[model samples]
Target: MYRTILVPLDGSGNANKALDIAAHLARANHARLYLLHVPVITEKNDDSLVTSPSQNDAAMQLIQTALETIDVSDLDTSILVRKGTPAEVIEREAHRLDADAIIMGYKGLGRTSNEKGGSVSAAVNHRAACRVVTVR
Candidate 1:
C-alpha cells in the first residue's frame, strides 16, 4: 500500500540490507524510492571526530556507491543528503516528502547501545508521521 518509500542510509551494511528490502518492496508495489543520507555532525574541537564537511562527502560517496550496486531499473529513485541528527532529519524528510513509509536498517544496538536511554531508531519510531520499518 505504500506509494513513496523512504530509506535512510548511513553507509553501513545494515542500511544496505534495508535498502535491498525497500527496493524489492518498491518494485513490487510500483512505488517510488527515496534514498536519504544523514550526515553525522560532531562538535567543533571534537578532534576525536572529523569535520562535518568531510563526513558528509564520505557518506554521500558511500551512498552513491551503494546505489550503483543495486539493480534499480524497476523503481524510480531519488537521493537526499541532509545535515542534522539522523532521527530528526529522517522524520522531517519523511513528512516533507509525504512518504507512505520509512524503511531503515536497525543496527540492533543491544542493552549497551540503549543504556544512554533512547536510540536513534527509537526516537524516529516515536516521532515519524508515517509508518517506520526497521530491517534488522
Candidate 2:
C-alpha cells in the first residue's frame, strides 16, 4: 500500500530490524526505499560546523553496511546522509521525498536508548505526515 518508504538507520539493532522490515514492505508494494542516516556529531570542527569528513564517512558506511545485509537487487533504493536533528531531518526528508510510509527504529543511540521508543523515533512517529512504523 506504500509507494515510497523511508527507513532511517542509526547503526542500532532496532534500526537494522527496521531496514529488514522496510525492505520486505518495499518489495511487496514495489515501492522506492529511501535510506537515511543522521550521524552523531561528537565534536565540532574549527569552523564550528557540526559536519566533518569522518562523520560523513561513518554515516555512509553505516548505510552501506545496512544495505549489504539486505538483498536490494530488485528494489529501487536511495541513500541519504544529512546533518541535523535526527527527527527533524527524517521528517523533512519524508515530506520532501513525498514518502508514503516511514519504517524506523524504535530506539537509537540517544540518552533514552533503553526506552521503548526513543526521542527521535517518537518525534518522527508524531510529526511525519505519512504512516510511521517503528521497529524495535
Candidate 3:
C-alpha cells in the first residue's frame, strides 16, 4: 500500500533497525525509500552553526553508515542531510516528499550518545501527515 517511504535515521543501531524494517517493506511493496539525517545544531567557541555534511565528517559518516547498514541496494533510495530539530525536519521532508509512511527508530542519539530522543519520535508520530512506524 506504500509507494514512497521516508526513513529518518540517527546513525544509531536502533535507527539501523528501523532501516532494516523499512527496506523489507520497500522491497515488498516496490516502494522508494528516502533516507534523511538531521544533525543537531552545534556551537563553536564563539558561534553556533548547523552542521553541514561537507564540513562535518560525523554527519557524512551518519549518511554513509546508514546506507551501508541497510540492504536497499535494489530499491530506489535517496539520501538527504538536513539541519534542524530532528522531528521538524523529518516531518517537513515527509510532506515535501509526499511520503506514504515514515519508519524510524523508537529512540535515537539525542543531545548525546547516552540519551535518546523519545520526545522527537513522539512529536513526529503526532505531527506527520503519514503513518509513522517507530522501531525499537
lDDT of candidates 1 onward, in order = 0.80, 0.86, 0.83
> Can you give the TM-score per candidate against the true fold?
0.82, 0.88, 0.85
Q: Which pairs of residues collide in candidate 3?
A: none
Question: Per-residue lDDT of 33-125 in model 3, one digit per residue for the tens?
Answer: 998887776654345445654536677688787777666889999988787677888999999999999999888877532125347788899
lDDT of 2: 0.86
Residue 70 shift from truth in candidate 1, angstroms: 2.3
Question: How well does candidate 2 match the true structure, expressed as C-alpha RMSD?
Answer: 3.1
> Best candidate, TM-score-wise?
2
Better of 1 and 3 by TM-score: 3
Ordered by TM-score, highest first, the candidates read 2, 3, 1
Off by over 4 Å in 3: 44-49, 52-56, 112-118
In TM-score terms, candidate 3 sits at: 0.85
Question: For candidate 1, what is the lDDT?
Answer: 0.80
Residue 21, model 2, lDDT: 95
Candidates 1 and 3: which is better by lDDT?
3
In model 2, where do residues sit more than 4 Å from their true spots? 43-49, 112-118
lDDT tens digits, residue span 17-85, model 1: 889999999988999999998766567464443447777778779788888877776789998988666
Give lDDT: candidate 1, residue 133: 89
Candidate 3 shows a clash count of 0
